[model samples]
Target: MSVTETTVSSPLPPGKYYFSGNEALAEGAIAAGCNYYAGYPITPSSEIMERLAARFAGLEGRVFIQMEDELASICSVIGAVWAGAKGMTATSGPGFSLMQEAIGYAALTETPLVLADIQRAGPGTGQATKVASGDLMQAKWGSHGDYQPIALCPWSVQEMYELTITAFNLAETYRVPVFLLGEEAVGHLQERLDIPAANRVARRHYQPGAPPFGHPDPAGVPSMPAFGQGEKLLVTGSTHDEYGFRRTDDPAAHARLVARLNDKILQHRDRIVSTRSYRLEDAEIAIVAYGFTARSAWLAVDELRRAGKKAGLLRLRTIWPFAAAEIAALGSSVRQIFVPVPPADRRPDHLPGNHHPGGTGAVAWPATWKNTCARAPTAPRSVPAAATAS
Candidate 1:
């Protein structure tokens, strides 16, 4: 057992204890400085809220609210953030579907928050306890409009913990809603997780009189000022000026405001996108995957290698700002690129549907089976990974 020091000079527990992915997510949120968690209980994702409910009982100023419904759940999280607290919420398919409106509000208001979707099979009341990777597309497009979303897909229990912390850091850094897309298998899988020391301290970047929105720091992200901060701020979903005044009727203002929102994420993409290139060097075929489906892809790729076939995997750590350049490069280098999607996602021309907010939808995920998000088989730019990212 060894302890790793973090940026905040806090101490990580120096031992190993078996923990489920959902439990690790709770611990990670706490470590990342999340003090407010409001959520409705949903299968798979319920463990996350449940774990936090018990943990927060002993921590001062930390709150765990079992909201009456997903609507109330998202509202509580948004309210908590406005009051200068780090906020987080966890849910599955149905709850995720219910959260779209608030998700849009978070994006339009540029609220720094984290949402975790421990995906299960869906559309309606799919499997409750069964593992599924169904929410991959919904996490991106479920919210409306043109906004860049930062979504992290974790394949294992370790990644579930690490990525949850990363999601918080990114949410604050970008002043955007960040999503942690965890499949059911990873959410409930028990494994030894070594708790890492706390590193990040959540905070607002506002000065007493600075504008609350519309000013993109050189980093391309606006420094956010929460309510109750000394700054006089007006936060709303309507198109607004940098000073937070609405310009909903002005086409130019509307265009510029929306464009800035998109540009803040797209223009400085490298800062927000992350991917794992596995054995890509000199490989002939590439397996592109994310979330739970990535686990099977890796195994299949590994098995093919033992049989002496050149193979590799491109694991998507960040799905929203999908790794277009990397995927494009693979298109040129590899003889074949395989994306292992679930049977429901197997329909031909399914990639476009996933990319279109109105097209088909993010459906079921594979548990001990193959699940995946589709990339273009030939044209990298033509294929869409997480289409509704904002």
Candidate 2:
């Protein structure tokens, strides 16, 4: 059968429908006005590319290319973005690793793009089908630079759809790369997705003479000009002046450019970081979590409350530009904090449960947890790891 006819609602219309998280993410990209997609097929994330290809096949002005590898896929997406098209790519852990260099380049150039990472078990090609939130640290620090990235974590199929659109909007607004971090479980889970009739999409503003790489305000986002726009634009990954001239050995220029790239996102973090509180108002204990684990954490909070424990949930919708302020605020009012970490996680510091709230803390894990709480360096003085939910 043709991909268009066989796929689930290619270019889905505005309505409620049953969809997998990966499929919903593809539809969300369409709804967000993404016109270019380049990606390699990697298990859980492959479905997103498949859906986008099916949709692009039936549409005009949209492009889809199955790149030979993740390196080529990310490069193509970057090129498309510079060519004035809303572009994106999807990949899993191994592919994500390969794209780090290009991701750093995109950050230095302030390229606006979206990347969906459906994480699987891994340090290096661990398990393709098994679920794990192992890419949490890699998404933030993998590029090896002072650049800041916006990453959103989705806990359900519906969130996978909504957050994908949010990822595009954030990318365009900040002129930076954005990541939609999903896990194998959520990406493959089937659930209801409600599509709205209209979405508030951000459109990149182009001004002819404005400097594409620098602005007077440290946290300001410069107007982006497309390649064929007759503007004398020079794009480079090296340290550069406001006009994008190469400033290889100029320390001042390098410092200024690097600082702005970070401040633009870090200073405006209030707008980029997103979190949702569940029964936090009167609770004495707070459970902070994100991605797939947040789903179980939410349930655990409800169960704790039923047992006369005043428990609450703080769900992290945005992972990067870490919600430090929110976590601190929640900590001040709570007696203890509980954070659920993925079972048998290979990286300890990358664990979401390691966020130190400056209070007594507990690490929640499933029955299969092989790591101890002591391994978490930033975690607050901890009690024994508790078996919370499966």
Candidate 3:
């Protein structure tokens, strides 16, 4: 059967189906082969648990656990994954903080798991009800070491559904933790989500009896063996070689293993990174943003274009690995690249510098022609523009 046909859902008899973002995520997970969920209830994310619990109730081999806390939640999910089950968890900012250590462990061990952080304002419990994109940096580097995570940022309810499936595919493909980074507004927003048919869903499976970390493809992503596949698997957080054995004292083993784990995602960035471009072809000014910030930036771009100004939009869908090449190519055509600087907490600081001739402009909302151009370190000079009313 064709790949699309294999995962495509049979057409539903002409009827209407309405779902909230949380429900759509649950449906997406079920379609993506997720059989386990371990998470604690937290604002803006608790509905995901509720929906999954109800959906998985009568399904055999499916497990849902309400752990005592977020840390335990992630820890349990990791154990579930090791037991040969596809596992996941959902949380908001505060709970996400508690789960950081466990997330780091999953990263170190090259565990395939999906984590959804429906973010809220906070360093520690800032604003639970308000919307914010402050977790962008954390999603990429929340864990304490030099590890890479495939992160998907969804702006709307439909994207929330689509990205959940993409997150699982990335997790299984890279054999590493994947994150769905959403803020309060997007996570809680209610909208119509197009649920793809089962056959359209992509499922990742291991070669029967394959070694846990054995690479069957040119990329270092190994064919992941399930826990009960009769393989004597030894999984650990310590630096290990391809054989999945602990080799903490071996410098070469450490370097090789770490590089492979990180490179597996970085090497395939072209296939992984996705963005939405609007009026970018010949525009002189482009606004680069993601999540809710992108929504506003797109609106502003539309308004600017309507006013005969040369404006376009570059909306990011995959936040990690930074999409540097694509951004650089887009920057080459634009005069000024305006990036909506989200609230401090959600900003992606490691994003590569813009290579445009006019440099990068960081714009805060409701301001017009108020550009702050920071030249690259090797560039000739910096240009600052006085704030003008929008």
Top model by lDDT, which number? 2
Query: TM-score of every model?
Result: 0.86, 0.89, 0.85
Evaluated at residue 211, the lDDT of candidate 1 is: 63
Candidate 1 off by > 4 Å: 1-6, 9-12, 198-204, 216-219, 348-390
TM-score for candidate 3, please give it.
0.85
Residue-level lDDT of model 1, residues 1-390, one tens digit each, is 011224653334645768899988888887787899999999979899888999888878998889899999988999889888889999998999999999999988888899999887776998887776666667767788978788898877778878888888878777789999887888998988876554554455655565666664422556666677666678878888878898888999777777877777777678778989888897876777887778777877777778777889988898887676666667677766666666544443444234543443322222234343332222222232242121
Per-residue accuracy of model 2 over 140-229 as CA lDDT, tens digit each: 889987889899999999999889988988999888999999999999999999987677777776677988888889878888989888
How would you order the candidates by TM-score, starting with the best? Answer: 2, 1, 3
Better of 2 and 3 by TM-score: 2
| Residue 99, model 2, lDDT | 98
Q: Give the local distance difference test score of model 3.
A: 0.73
Query: CA shift at 271, candidate 3, in angstroms?
Result: 0.8
What residue pairs are clashing in model 1? 133-365, 140-388, 147-390, 149-389
The local lDDT score (0 to 100) that residue 103 gets in candidate 2 is 96
Ranking by lDDT: 2, 1, 3
Instruction: For model 2, give the 10-residue run with minimal summed lDDT.
Output: 1-10
Per-residue lDDT, model 1, residue 7, is 62
